[model samples]
Target chain A: MSKPFLSIENMTQTFPDGQGGTLTVFEDATFGIDKGEFVCILGHSGCGKSTIMNILAGLAEPTSGVVKMDGFEVSGPSLDRGVVFQNYSLLPWLSTLKNVTFGVKARYPDWSKAKVEAHAREYLAMVGLEGDVVHRKPSQLSGGMRQRVSIARAFANHPKLLLLDEPFGALDALTRGTIQDELLKIWGGTEQTVFMITHDIDEAILLADRILLMTNGPFARVAESVEITIPRPRNRTDIVEHPNYYAIRNHLVQFLGQRSKELAGQQSGGEPQSPTRVVIDKTGPAPDPEPTTKPQLRAVND
Target chain B: MLDNLSTNQRAAVLSVVMLVVGLLIWEAAIPAQKAASELTEYERLTGGGAPKAGVPPPSQVLAKAWEQLSNPFYDAGPNDKGIGIQIGYSIYRVLTGYILAALIAIPLGFLIGMSQVAYKAFNPFIQVLRPISPLAWMPLALFIIQDSEASAIFVIFICSIWPMLINTAFGVAGVRQDWVNVARTHELNGIKTAFMVILPAAAPTIITGMRISIGIAWLVIVAAEMLVGGTGIGYYVWNEWNNLDLTSVIFSILMIGVVGMLLDSAFGFLQRAVTYAE
Candidate 1:
């Protein structure tokens, strides 16, 4: 296969456990995201999913390994990789227009004030916020609106990659669905590469082109990559009725519900092998056309 | 009349009524001074007929207050100026010292807050110097500076610095880590992040510190001026005391209260301006 647009090469993260011993968060986890691909990582809490995202965003460093985008090694934060934090991380003092403008101006310093503001307002309008609401501060907006502002800020930079850490995790279910639709619409038009971390199985299936399932940590690894076979223009309401939806959904739910904990306990003492690829049947539940071998597990050193 | 008043208005009316009642009681309590049978040598030397022990009646204070207010800007000499001039001198000293403290404290505070090394190195010195009274520095200031006015100003500087310095540091350090993360994700440099993100986030708290410093500065200036014996409101009060003129002293005390309130309210306005809901 040709080189992916973004490559995570054997990234490992460790922290001191405060007893003069190191705690491994994850070890030698490897993955790659192709250009313009929408990928979601699914893991239970404390599985080092955010740690991996942080490394990709260049907000943190792995214990050993490198993340390269295109040809250059990622070192620190850049406007090229925009992150949408779960907390909505809007600078509360500024209005929505100013908040988006702040990032746009930072990304394109040569752009005039009017041009920057117009660019920011365009993105804000794309997220369904316009008119007087764009002038309101984050505190004045509802939780959903604030997240939309964060999304606008991230997209306004026209980043090469978008990193979302459970962006809709804090919103109500109704609001989450609406924003998810809006997000899908935006992503469909732009074809931006997205790496989102979410534990919601259906959300991953609906939003990501490929869903990466991670085993539970301390020696956590990406166990498998499930390719969603659903067709485009999928609706949250109609997507569930699709023939392949339950097959993909059941496969993900089973891994998270049963296999994740089992794999956590099964590791014996060597390096973790990279995740295997699993292609779901598009028509209906059927035996795999090609048999894929399970990854070799090893004992973990404590 | 009381039915339409809000809680604050009712409270204000009660305060005036209480003041009137207290003044009435004071007026009735002191009997018209009896003719003096014998005067002590000290009393004769100072002033033969001045009331020695009784608190001055409210009527005499009111009359003195009116006289001072009518010609507040009069400058008779260095030792004797009108109430307005005395107040103006006191305000000038407090502002000069307070502003000097802010200039030094704010930038140092930002440095200490942002750098762990600076915080660790400077914290002990701040703690050591903070608790010493501003007036306790008056004698040293007077001896070293050899200028009473400068000493008083220095005393105000010393008293005001701690709150602003400590508050600013606290405010800066307490800025949300998520906001800093946002700055980092945006690739904002250290200077831009500090000025654009941290400063606004810490502003309300910094203003709180400034409000506190102004209050302490105002309080310290009075006692410092009293100690240094300069031409300020404090000196005016002291001079009136030497002549045993309780009415003028009482009037000046009221003036001091009014000026302190004005200073505090001015800072309160600034504090409100910078305050954000989130």
Candidate 2:
């Protein structure tokens, strides 16, 4: 296999409890993502998925680990990594256009005004927001609309990596589905690398090139990295009829169920010993399968 | 939705209804409202012989007001400054004092509010001086400044500071942590974050404090002018009282109420303009 684009090696993080005891969240966890890969991480409530994302983004520190992107170690957040948060973190005082353009202006201050506006408008329209709303403040927008603005803002800069921490978690089911479809469409066509955290099984299967599952914490580790076998441009409705869909879903369900049982037992003192080896299902074949057709990757603005 | 009624119309309707009701009560209380005055002036109106007193009815007050308004500046000659001049003078002083208080108070309050160390250092001094009355400052201001206008202005400045200062501090302190985090994520350092994010986020509270300060400023001005003896509406009321002209005194009091109402309404509009309601 070719060298991975982003790599996290032996990452561990701990915090002092202020009572002379230390709380360890992750321990020597290692993972790597290839260029333009879309990965979703699924975990239970205390799984430290967000903590891992924060460390990868350089917003938080791991006790011991190296996060390397394209062979360069990440010391802090940079324009190359754009993050979209769960609550649609659009600055309320700025108009939709300004919010979207904020990143562009900061990252490319030398760009012409027309260039900046065109760049921002392209992304905003890609996210399905009309130009009329470009001048309106975030407070004037609905929740879903605000989240779309956030997505537009994140994607406008054309970052090398997009990090989403349950970006649609606060939306209604219908809204979430619409957003999920939009996100898949945007990510699929662009070949943009995405790393997201979610608890929803359907969301993971629908969007991810691969899914990383984590065990529950005080000490969590990447339990498995399951590759979705369903073909490209995967439709949620059609994928259900695929031969391996149910089998993959059942495998994930059982894996999570067993982990939940283990976590419960450990909490209740019903089990003492730690599980020696974590099984991360890579689904079918071990390396990636060769493509038989010309990939139809399209940049969002185009 | 009643979109036909603009915000101004709604407020105007409510204000008009309140004013009418107040006028009716004043009319009804004419006898009682003037009872103290009528008791003393009974001998003169009754030709020094009777108990029946002559307390002017509400109609008589209006007649005098209308008579005065017909040629409002006849008493002032060609200078021709009607009640508007008195109002203008009072407004000028209030604007100067209130603006000075806001300019000084807001920054000071923000500093104290943002830093726990500054808050501890200044909190005691604020607590001690805040409760001291504007009238209490009048004598000291008069002696130090030795100018009636300056003294009255100083008194207003003292009276208005506490509310504005406290409100600014509260506003700055109450800024949402989420907003701060967003600012931090954008690489906005401390000063840029404070002015760009915190100030706007806390604007509503700061404006509310300014509203309270303006009200106090209006309240302080009347008393300050009365003590310092200036050419303000307060002094006009006092001058009328020395001549025993009860109607002019009543007229001046009405003017003060109207001016205060206008000042309050203007700030209310400003408050609504700056707020971005979540």
Among these predictions, the greatest DockQ belongs to 1
**TM-score for each candidate, following the candidate numbering:** 0.92, 0.81
| True interface contacts reproduced, per candidate | 0.76, 0.17
lDDT (Cα atoms) of all candidates against the true structure: 0.88, 0.78
What lDDT tens digits, residue by residue, belong to model 1 across residues A1-302? 68899988778888999999998888777788999999999998888999998888888889988889997899988889999999999998889899999999889999999999999999999999999999898999999999999999998898999999999999998999999999999899899999999878889888999999988988788988888888888889898999878878888878888888888733424564567887766674556545454322211121
- Residues B1-278 of candidate 2 have per-residue lDDT tens digits of 44789999988988999988887887787654334445556555665434344455566667766765665443374223466566667778888998999889999999988998998999999999999988888878878998889888888888888999999998898887657656655666689788878898888899999999999899878777677664677766777677666776677787789888988999899998888856
Write one digit per residue (lDDT tens) for candidate 2, span A132-151: 98899998988888889999
Instruction: Give the poorly placed runs of model 1, Cα more than 4 Å off.
Output: A265-272, A284-302, B1-4, B34-53
